[model samples]
Target: MDLKKVERVYTSYAGVYDQIFGKVFHEGRESAIRNLNVQPNERVLEVGVGTGLALPMYPRHCRIVGIDLSEGMLAKAKERSEALRLTHVELQRMDAGAMNFPDDTFDTVVAAYVVTAVPDYRKVVNEMIRVCRPGGRIVMLNHFRNGNKLIAAVEKVISPLTKHLGWRTDLSLSTVLEGTTLHVARKQQVNPLRFWALVECVNAKNGYVVLNGAAASYANGNGAAGYAHGNAGGHYASEHSV
Candidate 1:
């Protein structure tokens, strides 16, 4: 993928992106964050932050660093920070595929509506996992290609044109999940059309296993296992919910 072209596409529309995508994907974004259950002192990194639409929603107690390749969008995000008094949120202009952070730097890392737009989705995902500490939550809120044959065919036809607009319409769930250690904690269909996917995965490290649909986290040093289960109201039990 041409990085310059991708940068240009997002930069050109930084001013109008919120109007175009804000409400359309708001439900998924909200659900992802709620499920994340970010704590007061957690360090969170938001890749492909773009215009900082979710900045205002983040907990004020936690520290949030949002990065995007588009300088224009980062500029808007900065303005949003000041305008909305989001003191805890920081915005930067950087490529998500090649972030310059140390290993295990963040407690939780999130990517909203970005996988399909990145030049290399796998690289960005691995980077997100590498920077996140063990037992961290990796959340993604985006529109995946429909599983239905006719709808998928229509999405594929439109993706070529849509990619130029800074996103794709035909990104598949399996395509992104392949070769990743992240496991789905829950999968929900959001939005009025029910086309968007709210996928939450746990960034489980060494000695991880899922039993009976719940993630049971067991590390070498601990005899106590962390069991997480899905709660009907949306949020999962933190650490030992199962």
Candidate 2:
């Protein structure tokens, strides 16, 4: 959340990020993009595209633009784009909280493993929603605070050190959705431990529509296993992947 601190932290991480996070979080990034089911010629926006890890996975037909606040991260992303010949992807260094695009610009907006890193998570969400079309989709792949008291307590103790890593370990899904128009249409557990979540939703004009019993504990497999239930008319309750 601290811009200056994040800049300092990732300034030197661009070169080694792949070695550290590539394999561990690879599934999370792949699953998030796959869930998008992008159609040809669709306009897509990726927020906080650290080192452009997902750029190659994106469909070549789609007009994809990735934005991040960290120039350290964007520099590597640019190189990746060039190396891989990802002509459809564009990298830009910009604050997610204050996006420059107009309303209803992108058909699908995705944020991969970056919700808690921004100075204003809420503002970033709003911007993502604002740029997304009315019937578009907004997907997020992120880690949240564990519901276990012991795990949460430990996270709190080390929360101060998160600034150095450029992300927080105690963020909650509810905290990220404090005042957003999007909702969790589907939630899939990514990563081996299922610590990371792949959330997919539509850009509804109404308020958020999270599935029933959507909570950190629910995702952690302590309470109930993930399941999706439908309501009258149209609504889907939250559930984990198979």
Candidate 3:
């Protein structure tokens, strides 16, 4: 994808983007944050942190660094951070495939709806894990290829159009993790589109497990194991096995 074109598209939509797509893409934001399990005062990094939607949900005392490729998105994110008084969160305009951070620099790293957007998904994931502490978590909320054959067929049909519309319809969450050290700790389906999924995993560990079934349901204020909708801003809380 052309970097300039991507920047232009997002920049053009930055102001009204949330209003138009928030309900659709922001559903799992809170869940992704909770699953991160960041401790107070820990260093955290969020990739593709559009408009800083997750900023308000971070542990209040933690230091957060957010990176995105779109300067237009960062401008809105900066306004949001300032408005919410999120003094600890910093925003930077950077590409996900190429990060400027050092190795093992953060306690936790997060990527929300970012995998599909980047041309090189694996490279970005490797970078995310590289910068995270050995035992740290890499929490993600994204759209993937559902194992259902019928759904996969439909996704294939619309993939070209979806891609043209600024969405990647073919990046399977499971496929992307292949040959990597990231281990799946939990997973849940979030939408019928068979695209949105919530996944919690640790970097380079054995005894990996893939959750096979429906999305989880939970009561209010529960934790990481609950039902979450969309991608970023909404999620039901519940306890999860990590």
Candidate 4:
């Protein structure tokens, strides 16, 4: 990925980014964080922590270290952290695919709406799991290939243009999580218009099992609601009734 180009675009638009994508972006973000069930004093690391949108949602007692590839984004994130008076949060410019932290350094790792932005998402995911403790969580809030034919068509049609605009419409969350140790804990469709979603997962074995599913009802309350049926293709979607 062209870090210079990414930094330039984000820096130039930082002032208006919130106003432009605020509605769709904020909803998915809030839902993702809420479903995370983060506890106090947890050491958390946020990859691609652009503008520090999740900083305010974190517990005050938790320690947070945010990293982004774009210096422009990190600058805005620093401003947000200061504005929120989050003394425990730190912002730095770093690549998501290559983190500087030690292995198992963080109790929890978060990546919100960032999978699509990074050039090498698989490497980034592996890096996230590598830094997280054995029993810790990895939460993701992102937009992916919705099973709807109409939306899929639209995504395919505009994907080329969207890619130029910093959007990777081709990467699906379902495929992204495949064969990874991060288990899906909870997931909900944020909004169809934006194709956004809130998904939570935990690291386990060679592949991640859905931790919030019927097998582990204690992980999250959603499991007790009974397993909701969906298509067999592995893609699931839930309209934002929240």
Candidate 5:
């Protein structure tokens, strides 16, 4: 996908984004931050924080740094942050595939509706892992390819058309996580017809040796791991739900 075209599409949508998509993806956004389980004083990073829709949902006890590629989107997010008086929040214009933060910078990293929207999804995932501390949480909310053969076939056919609208529908969850150090602990289908996925992973960089008990449990195949299908409120086994 062309980066310029992608930026242009989202920049143009900045004004009407909340009006059009705010309610449609509200459940998934709320579920992602709620399940984030952020701790007091912990540092958090939000990738592609478009319009800061999830900004108000986050607890103010922790510090949050939000970044996006579109200046228009960031402008709206800044307005939201100011309107809500979220003193702990910071906004920046940056590319998701090449973040400017150093290694192990944040306690949790969230990417909602971001994977398929980028030019190189794997590169962005790696960047997420790079900036996240060991055993930290990497939460992603997006729509992956349908598991059903018939549905997957249809998505592939219309993927080109969808890409023009700023995102592709043919990306699979596995493809996004493959070769990355993200150890997924939970993958749930959430909200709006159960068409989107909320994947919670543990940043197991270096190896499983860096993981804590919760993350290690997943790597050892001893934890309860399953694909959940339902609304955002749907419960699933988790490693970071403290």
Candidate 6:
């Protein structure tokens, strides 16, 4: 997944991206924000905020900084922000692998449909963790390699072909979290056929559990406070289990 190619592919899709992905991925976007559970006046950063489809869904009280590498996509996002009169939103064209923000700059960091699209998913994830404050939330909404062996094989075969469309199909959740201080507090399967995943992690570099509400208060029996499987009412997965 070359960065230049990804940019070109999204630039071409910018005009119709909302129509193609808006409704299909709407539920996952909404779920990801809900998992974020942002507080008033918190600083939030969104990577790969293509077309800003999730813009209007965020609470207006929190400050939002949305970034993407594709200029064409950012243009559409700008239009959406203006039309919605979202004064709290800010849009910038920036690389996900190399964000300009300083460490611990944001209260929450989100990346929807972003993990598999970048050239180096690990680099992007590391950058996300670097910018987000310790104990803050880092929400990811995207498809991971299926757990079923048969499906995983099929995805591996199709991954090369999908790269041209600006995403890969064979990335695993464990692979994305490798070597990171992020702890998977919750993960839920969303979208049609449950093809996509909505994962919420705590930036646990400081060893603090900071997620709020019932989701955070519910004990997982392992002493953790979040659910591992949102649909099954499962216990929370350990830090590396996601």
lDDT of 4: 0.70
Clashes of each: 0, 3, 12, 0, 0, 0
Off by over 4 Å in 1: 213-242
TM-score of 4: 0.81
**Tens-digit lDDT track of model 6 for 114-220:** 99999999899999998986656688999999999999999999999999888999999999998889877678899888999988876766554433333333322
RMSD (CA, Å), candidate 3 to true, equals: 7.4
lDDT of 3 by residue, 114-217 (tens): 88777678889989988875545677888887578898888878887776556677678768899887766567766446358888765543332323344333
Q: Taking the tens digit of each residue's C-alpha lDDT, what string does model 4 give over 58-158?
A: 77866889998777768888888888799999888888888899887876788887888777789889999899865466778788886888888888787
lDDT of 6: 0.82
Cα lDDT listed for each candidate = 0.77, 0.75, 0.72, 0.70, 0.81, 0.82
The residue-by-residue lDDT of candidate 2 on 1-242, one tens digit each, is 57776776776788899899999999999988875666667788999888998899988977899998778888999999999999898888888888899987887788988787777788888989998865467888988888889998888788778856788888888777766666666777899799888887666543323444332211112222222222222443223222
- Give the 10-residue window scoring lowest on summed lDDT in candidate 2: 216-225
lDDT of 5 at 188: 77
> How high is each candidate's TM-score?
0.86, 0.83, 0.81, 0.81, 0.87, 0.87
Give the runs in model 6 whose Cα sits over 4 Å from its true position: 206-242
Instruction: Return the lDDT, model 4, position 218.
Output: 21
lDDT for each residue of candidate 1 in 7-63, tens digit (9 for 90 to 100): 998899888889987888788788777766665667889998888888888879788
TM-score of 2: 0.83
Model 3: CA > 4 A from native? 191-195, 205-242
In candidate 5, stretches whose alpha carbon ends up further than 4 angstroms from where it belongs are: 210-242
Q: What would the per-residue lDDT of candidate 5 be over residues 68-183, giving only the tens digit for each residue?
A: 99989999999999999999999999998898999888878999999999889988998999998666678899999999999999999999999989999999988888878776
User: Lowest summed lDDT over 10 consecutive residues: which window, candidate 5?
Assistant: 217-226
